[model samples]
Target: MDGRASFRRIAAVLGVSEQTVAHRYRKLRESGAVRVVGRLDPCYLGHAEEWVLRLRCAPSATLAVAKALAQRSDTYRIQLASGGTEISCHMQTSDQRARDTLLLDKLPATRQVTSIEAHQVLRLFRGGPDGWHTPIASLSPEQVTELTPPPPDPVPLDLDDGDRLLLGELAHDGRTHHAALAASTGWHESTVRRRITHLRASGALYFGVDFDEHLLGYSSHTLLWISVNPAALDAAGAALARSPQIAHAAATTGPTNLMATALCSSADALYEFITTQIGSMPGIQTVQTAPVLRIVKRAALL
Candidate 1:
């Protein structure tokens, strides 16, 4: 109930054995689905430049623009945001030269480009799998999972060394079949299945498809940083979380206190979603939208 996340309390309420809960929780961390990775300092990492790509596209060319951006490994995120322009991505590179080459020179080459601009990050704070370590602009509050306080669920788990190897292989490639995983990880099919179940049950594993919004016709996307009243954040966050358009939301430090990324069917739809949906809230003082041009890297990248 309170923020005191003791295993005993958690397990009791969830109606499962303490060991089961503990094991599953460890698995959640192991799986990339919920990680605790750190956000490196861009300057220290030699990524001193942060650029935002803003685009104005010709009618019905959303797919074309996204495809062009996706071809490069640097394209981190693409989403349809407000207006005719798409917020392609917020990216970081080692220096101005790389920024220019990818964000500037390469953008003009796209035939559908109506306009493009890359804005640099002056001072940035973002977190990755490690919260706040990803990017201030890409911040998305993790789902708050509240386990029902009860006697915990009981599930058997016996993962030996070989079984653990199988888990590692599957964690890297979810689609890998038991047979293939066995061959690669040096485990048998039955052992792989049992271990996989243990990992999933213990929260050490997860599998899902990664969505590339560009392919889904959401041609516009951007990251917005907003300063909202602390007292009002609870209400503000609840409201914004309700919007289907918002892909991610997270809290941050400094003038821009809240960061959110979204994929909209149209720029106007994005505008309405922000201005009408989240903006209508009382505590929101200001909002700055930076359209992403391309993403150089992401926390999800293995």
Candidate 2:
């Protein structure tokens, strides 16, 4: 789904019949094992300020707080932390003041929340659930080139109301028809097509495949908080980024400095990944692991 190829194109590339490709796609979609959704590059869209929040709350209030935050558009990823009393979330907002309201003013007002620690995301090495690499190398380079769409022109940094409306529609369904988008935005289908093309080419948007990892043989999902030597930051981050098991990785403000999310098929597999792949990397100082018990939200979808 990375390229959202047509069944015919994909079949041609894979040397399979179009009917076979169509059948497989239908099954995956029907089983709720996959979904293609559009995502925004927050920095390019003027929502540059981003944060990772870890909240310690009363055990009884954990689900309530997580569900409440998941309902907000500004929040991206929310997970129940390992201990069950803590919740971790990633959020972005256009302005610092608005970010404060979402991260500070709002949570403090909730009686269930006991404490909050917020880390400003410095530079994103990779973004998760949606942006990670896959172990399978399906399409060949030549086939991929044939299926790739023409690049769109860069769009203006400032988005008009209509642009935002179109983005919202894509966030709901990346493959949404142009006619449907036009109906929602009150624009001509041609205009909708132009806007989408521009937004994509400008590096302001991306499409991600969302699904239950279990369908892909991944059952354990965990977050890694690692502190590496200042000189080794780039190396450590790069190593993690290349791992197909890593769903997300970023350098952030705080003692830990680096954060990553990874998935494996089982608890033993997770242990092996941490010890062999992650631990063997250079400049690693301290490592803290938190298994995600439940995912409250992923991407823009609930």
In model 2, which regions exceed 4 Å deviation?
A: 1-3, 14-32, 128-130, 137-156
* TM-scores of the candidates in the order shown: 0.47, 0.88
Give lDDT tens digits, candidate 2, residues 124-172.
7877323775564665677657765665344557788988888888888
| TM-score of candidate 1 on Cα atoms, chains taken together | 0.47
Clash pairs (backbone) in predicted model 2: none
Q: Give the TM-score of candidate 2.
A: 0.88
Q: Which lDDT tens digits does candidate 1 get at residues 3-84?
A: 1145676666556788997687567545633422112233332434545555677747755676656555344445555453
Output the lDDT of residue 16, model 2. 93
Query: What lDDT would each prediction earn against the true structure?
Result: 0.55, 0.81
Worst 10 residues of 1 by lDDT: 127-136
